[model samples]
Target: MGLWDKIKDGLTTDKGEVAEDAQSQADNAAAKAKEAQDKADAAKKDAGQPDAPAAPAPPAPEAPEAPQARPADEHKPKRKPHREYTVVSGDTLSEIGARFGVDWHDIARINDIPNPDLIYPGQVFKIPNK
Candidate 1:
């Protein structure tokens, strides 16, 4: 039976019967949809086209290895001191300061810049340590 006709008939039945009927119809609809999808997949295979994309393959297992011991005296290399930065085209004091992890005002003060907004290309500015 058609969906609307089934629903109309359900409205005239007992509430419990109506709910059961609706559940049955929904289950049938789901079954039909799954069947249609299976047929489509088969048709695509017959036509030499790829089926719907599949779930990704699981990642490969990792190899278990013993951790290597390090010498106690070994330490991370120290960061080199930042001294100067030559301004390039489109280089701003704020951007240069950000690259060196310092404030633009500090860079301008250290470089004795007269106008903070008047920096030009090839002008070198001193970068202060953070």
Candidate 2:
């Protein structure tokens, strides 16, 4: 069985093991983020030293852009909103998409899945709006 299959098994057979795995992942992610932040802060601080030329202040976060104009369809009904799905044993993107009448690629794009082969059980992915 593959790593995904092992993860699926972990979800049902060993909840504590799955929780530990999740905690490890979360810790790794947090460490990476902190390291990146430290590097950025160091670079910024070094730039403003008396010997170096003054660095420009970082730009503020941009506000969300206004939605582009679309042709109004007052008569047509809106499609159903998207939903979230937790992956389970024997689940695949194609299978889930087929269940929801959505394309597997679309589901991957919605969840930003770089490698479709790497989905783990218990991972909650947001389905796109139809």
Q: Where does model 2 exceed 4 Å of error?
A: 1-81
lDDT of 1 by residue, 11-113 (tens): 7877898799999999999999889888988999999999975445789998898899997756877665658789998988899888988999889887889
Q: Positional deviation of 50 in candidate 1, in angstroms? A: 99
Model 1 quality (TM-score): 0.37
- Worst lDDT run of 10 residues, candidate 1, spans 73-82
lDDT of 2 by residue, 57-106 (tens): 78999999999887789558877567899999889899999998899999
Any runs in candidate 1 off by more than 4 Å, and if so which? 1-82
Error of 2 at 57 (Å): 50
Residue-level lDDT for 70 in candidate 2: 73
* Cα-based TM-score, every candidate: 0.37, 0.38
lDDT of 1: 0.85
Give the distance in Å from residue 43's predicted Cα in candidate 2 to where it truly belongs: 63
- Local distance difference test, per candidate? 0.85, 0.85
